[model samples]
Target: MNVPVHVLKGAGGKAAEQMAAMGIETVKDLLFYFPFRYEDFSIRRLEEVQHEERVTLQGTVHSLPELRFFGKKKSRLTVRVLVDGFLVQAIFFNQPFLKRQIELGQHLIFHGKFDKHRLMIQGAIVKNAQSDGAFEPVYPLKGDVKLVSLRKWISQAYKDYGDEIEELLPESLLESYKLIPRAEACYFLHFPQDMAKFKQAKRRMVYEELLMFQLKMQYFRKQTRESTDGKEKSWPAEKVNSFVEALPFPLTAAQSRVLEEILKDLNSPYRMNRLLQGDVGSGKTVIAAIALYAAVNAGYQGALMVPTEILAEQHSASLKELFAGYPVTIGHLSGSSKVKERRETLEKLASGEIDIIIGTHALIQEGVDFHQLGLVITDEQHRFGVAQRRVLREKGIRPDVLFMTATPIPRTLAITAFGDMDVSTIDEMPKGRKPVETYWAKPDTLPRVLKFIDKQVSMGHQAYVICPLIEESDKLDVQNAIDLHRQIQEVLPHLHTGLMHGRLHSDEKEEVMKEFAENKVQILVSTTVVEVGVNVPNATAMVIYDANRFGLSQLHQLRGRVGRGSDQAYCILLADPKSDSGKERMAIMTETNDGFELSQRDLELRGPGDFFGVKQSGLPQMKVADIVEDFRTLEVARQDAAKLVASEAFWKSEIYAPLRQALEEEGVFRKERID
Candidate 1:
């Protein structure tokens, strides 16, 4: 019986269950889940090893020590082992299992790096058989389980089911690429006979992974184009221009260009799907307001959906002011909005009394309907997925969709994920805004920085002291909001302080935020929740504690918090690392402020996994190809997928018949059904 692949991937439990969520459901996925690094366990003979050195020996146990408890917490067991006439002492902690495996005068093989005073094998898996072969295959396993058993299980699993897989690529392409067969790739990946086979299989598996991804993207793009007519109803420029002129800040040239593009999409009868991504404070909200202005003027309502209530309120207030004194009616609906008020808002929306509405997910909830919501706008669109966007689109007469994000996505990634939409990036920041001065600070610099915030506050400026964690917990040691709040209260007792985090109730948060916005509080302590919203123009300093705890894009976003106003803003990244990656993150912080540049730097520092981990980066994994190294292979896969699809419509082609059947084989995740 075939259970859902999700159920099977979870059969292993806990550690691997997440693979299903990542769309790694089949033997093919397991093959492509390549190891980030390897633990080399090749052993040298005891004669080649000195005391306190790591040495792998193929010898027998000459003597076994008694397995006795030295203390309630410590189990003492030691034995003298002979490696070609050289004596070495082996020890185990609470490991009678090792004693059971090796009897006195038993021949066994041991491989581990040696230390200066004793054998320093941090993690070693031993076997009872004696051999002088090359390094054995090791699988990624956890707990107290030994590597030998993992090797055994994998060997058996593959022997029983590996032969079921059929090659999914064309014969000529596979031959020219020198790619391994699907079955052999799976076999070698698990238990490679040699290094050459491991590399050979890895190359083929990576390419196949990318090819399958490209195929899925191609299908999704085609489906989207067919479903959308690219038709839009016209909204005049003078109407929106008059509204823009009435705003406080003049619309920048980039913002003007985006408004025209949106107007073009709106005027056309064809459905419009577009991604409008920009850097922080690049005036995307202004562009959105212009488009919404045009939408309401075109005799239809507009809905602006944001991820959180604070953002919704911000948009509603800004746009409400922009549309004020006009014929269009504007309102908001959020979780905190009272029931009677909500009912009235819904009525107004349903009856077409409201021309513009801004709210969180509450806008999409039941009872909220639009008589003619011709357009749906999602702010910080990365927070929602294609499904959520589809729900918004369906709410009206196939409303033209506009998605706005501050995180500038790489173009390749935008194509793969947002393939259904045309992408427009507002790369320019407004003039007169100075670049944020970023610095890598040590723990010792904390007091001086607090002094700076103190100075800023003293000079009538508010600041944001952000932490990664909300509160103290046993699981993690990062400085939480609660702890830092107390620490700051004690140091800066004269100033009023307010704390905001994810755990607080909605009303409670709104109240505290209102106090901060009204300047009732001089300094607001917060978590990453304040990364996107709660804009206070007077807040001049944003000091992020443990900045390395966040990804590059996130750190940049946090920095963006302070630079909003004309005041000299500073972003201090506090990190002292024990690893190279940590140091690299600090380097990225100092390198460039451009989100696109930072995104590529981040991709180089991390990988496709990082993109998935922080989907907000909006980078697409460009096929089984490495954007950094495998461009040639990726280009080949792209050409092949395009050629085959164009030549005979791969969805129906004889060459792709088996591949189509393979897609149905349940081992796949995020499979795109051919239309």
Candidate 2:
């Protein structure tokens, strides 16, 4: 099983290199590399054949192969075959080399779509009729690797090392779940006898993959819970309550509840690994502020890490304003901080003078040190990587970690991606805030939309006209910021219009955002760069051009830019969607303002990969299990894995030896940790 793939038959030279490119380095990798799809080659009679139906036919060649050249090294190979007493033309494209293998009166099997009107088969492939299986496994190929070579090599590997593949799941689990054995699964997955057996094989593999992933999550959760170095900080009820009471507005019930949960985690002996999720303008910042104040009141310094410098500055300003009249000292740090200011801030931070420091990725740099750092809060938590968060947390001795995201993650993703952490959501809006009213319109209504924006701006409120692209693309017939900005200015030349996109320098973007926030730019036309970290309370009207080009979460986030203030806000989606999904997205946006519900809908529309970016969240890329499609199965696997991890049998019993060894090999559990 440990043998190199290069040593396998027909895989010695460039084929080995290509297989390595496909991530097949060892015999084990080859065996476990499952097929993406299977083609049914079950024999079908002419009487049962339907037009354009994919069918496999066995025949004897009635005529010699004729090869003809076409455009750019392409060729057409055709032969007349006798199938079920009828003469049919079999055609293959770009396989002129097969003419050498074809002969008169040779028996052949062809698999492709049948055209009854033409009495022909658009042959995808032609093989010797001696092939055994009723189904063909099609593997994902890369480089110059062909499907035939992969099938041949995988078959060789299975024949050589099939029984050596060890079963990772315990015997009790196998019996309870009725899962097929590991070797049998590998066989069926690579070579299926029938659809029923193939499905069974796939189920076992999917469950196994999800189970292992959950076990790793539960193990880390167990480690985090079992750690003894967590700081059991004192919750100064008097100071916290005083600060809360001093606020201008009362905390919403949801905010109060989430704050209470955080305070409880802070007071407990266990480390707080909690996720704070709320919709845009849902007052999550205030909850984080209260938590930071509590951390300071406990005589420990705190840190707030954001994704961008602008957000860092915004957080610092908001936090400082909230902590006014208190003894807490707030410091701001970023990559753009002046040399002298940074030096002083670092010195103060090290000497325990700054109670709370707000910064971007600069907070996790090597030179930055925390003075008794007891609380670590990361805003827009998904924007940061696991290692970055870990480095910030490692600055202190088991500091309680609070992660905040304005993008409301669908519950399925929250459980599968952040399964190891506790989650708290603030679904309710504050007292006087109004929900942004959304509308969808056709391109012909653009004149009316512009008139509306002009009216809003005249009424002392600003507006944002969002475009999907920065420059007009010949490929996509959508509006771009540059041209849209020019056109908007041409239409309403009197309004002070500002343009901001991702291409602008950080300082330039900041300047544009500043001008917009200060109401100097009444109408800001830009791209999706303003989809996050831009808070403009006075901007009451948002016009999204080509709104169908964006995802639901993104459209929701853009709409959130407005309606932050007490004034009623309106969002107009200018879209002429041609597809059902695009129309559905626009309809969903106008239907409700609940981010959570929209997120669930978004998950169904666009799978987990595109929902808030799956890769950026550091989620394990599974081979078989889909967190979206297989959410119920994921829930079951999570529960079962948690049960197993909680029991001593998983670590001690001989029956679980294979499971432990498998996990250990994956680095899910180290030997020393288990011991």
- lDDT against the true structure, each candidate: 0.72, 0.88
Query: Lowest-lDDT window of 10 residues in candidate 2?
Result: 666-675
The residue-level lDDT of candidate 2 at 46 comes to 82
TM-score winner among the candidates? 2
lDDT of 2 by residue, 572-608 (tens): 9999867565899999999999999999999999888
Worst 10 residues of 1 by lDDT: 1-10
Error of 2 at 328 (Å): 2.0
What TM-score number comes out for model 2?
Answer: 0.86
Tell me the deviation in Å of residue 134 in model 2. Answer: 3.0
The regions of model 2 sitting more than 4 angstroms off are 41-133, 579-581, 670-675
Quote the lDDT for 407 in model 1: 75
Cα error, candidate 1, residue 329 (Å) = 3.2
